[model samples]
Each structure stands twice: as structure tokens, then as C-alpha cells.
Target: MQLTVPDFVGFVGVALVVGTYFLSQMGRMDVRKPLYPGLNGIGAILILYSLSNTFNAASFVIEVFWLVISAAGLIRALLLKSR
Candidate 1:
């Protein structure tokens, strides 16, 4: 099977998300930092975009929640910084 642009995008998203997690585990990334959530949000969005062309219920649900959670984390970080 041949890979498409969306597939590449989805792979990049997976890499970003997984890399962030790996960094966090290695103490190179702080979970509370905006960068962490921002990466996650962007990655989730990319994955969602890919999913738009080939939908999967479970994957879609998880990505939706991941995006939502990342958004919440980013918002919380911003609010904290503002205070």
C-alpha cells in the first residue's frame, strides 16, 4: 500500500506526541510548560486532520479527548502565567 500526505502528517504527529512523552520521562520536558501541551495540541490536530479522510471511531474519540485535554492544559498554563 502506498502512503499519502495525510499518512505522513499522522506519522509526524505521532512522533511529536511520543517524543514529547519521551522527553518528559527523561526530565527534559516539563508537563506544566505550555510547550508540552502546545505540542500535544498541534499533534492531535494533525492526527485529526488525517483521520478526516479515513475515520476510525476509537482513534477519533481518543484524539478528540487528547486535543481537548491539551487545549485545557494550555489555557490553564496561560491563565497561571497571567496571574
Candidate 2:
């Protein structure tokens, strides 16, 4: 088979999301850090972009939620930093 740009984007997105989780699990990264949710939000955006081409309803829905949650985490982190 052939690999397209969207495919590559999706793979990177998946990697970022999974890598972030793995780092958090191993305590290499802090969940409260902006970088954590920042990477997650970026990954979700890339995934959503890839989905625009293939169009999977389930994956799209889940990614949307993931993006939202990541955004909330980022905001919370910023708020805490301000305190």
C-alpha cells in the first residue's frame, strides 16, 4: 500500500498522545505541566485533521472529546501557575 500525508499526520498524532501517556505513567513528565496537555491538544488537532480525510465518526467524536479535555487541563495548569 501507499502512505499519504494524512496517514503520516495520524501516526504522529497517535505517537504524541501515546508517548505523553507513557511518559506520565513512568513519571518522566508531570501531568500538571503545560507541555503534557499541550502535546495532547496538538495530537488531537492533528488526529482531527487526519479524520477530515477518512471521516470516522467514532474516532472523530472521541478525538473531539480528547481535545476538549486537553484544553481544560491546560487551562487548569495555567490557573494553578497563577496562584
Candidate 3:
């Protein structure tokens, strides 16, 4: 198997997004805030993008479930903040 430019780009993008989330969670980065919603959105987008290159039914279902749960949490947080 060979790596393509798109694959490299996608991997880099995902790494950055996931790394940012972990950094924020660990309290390592203050300026670069990794909000839950933002992280979830990025994750969802990345997973969707990856589906095009290599599709997996099981993985797809799991990712979709994750996206839905994350979105719900984010929405709840926003609502709480607004109140």
C-alpha cells in the first residue's frame, strides 16, 4: 500500500484536531482553546472525509453515533450557558 497526498493531508488534519483536543483537556494550551463543540465538529468532518477514501460499515456507524452524542452534549452545554 502506498500513501497519497490526500491521505497525508487528511491524516495531518485529523492529528492536529485530535491533538488540540487532548492538549486542551490536559490544560497544556490556554490560548488555543479546544471547545467540545468545535472538537466534535472537526471530528465529525474528519470521519466523514475519511469515509470517501476507505469506507467501513461498522466504523461508519460508530462514528455517526459519536457525532450524534457529541452534538447533543455540545448543544446541552450551549443551552446551559445561555440560561
Q: Is candidate 2 or candidate 3 better by lDDT?
A: 2
The pairs that clash in candidate 1 are: none
Q: lDDT for each of the candidates?
A: 0.92, 0.94, 0.66
Q: Tens-digit lDDT track for model 1 on 23-63?
A: 99999999988999999999999999889778899999999
Q: What lDDT tens digits, residue by residue, belong to model 2 across residues 1-83?
A: 78779978998999999999999999999999889999999999999989877899999999999999999999999888889
Greater-lDDT candidate between 1 and 2: 2
For model 1 the local lDDT of residue 42 reads 94
> Candidate 1, 5: how far from true, in Å?
0.8
- Can you tell me which runs of candidate 1 are displaced by over 4 Å? none
lDDT of 3 by residue, 3-32 (tens): 765566557656755776687679875422
lDDT of 2: 0.94
Best by lDDT: 2
List ranges where model 2 is wrong by over 4 Å.
none
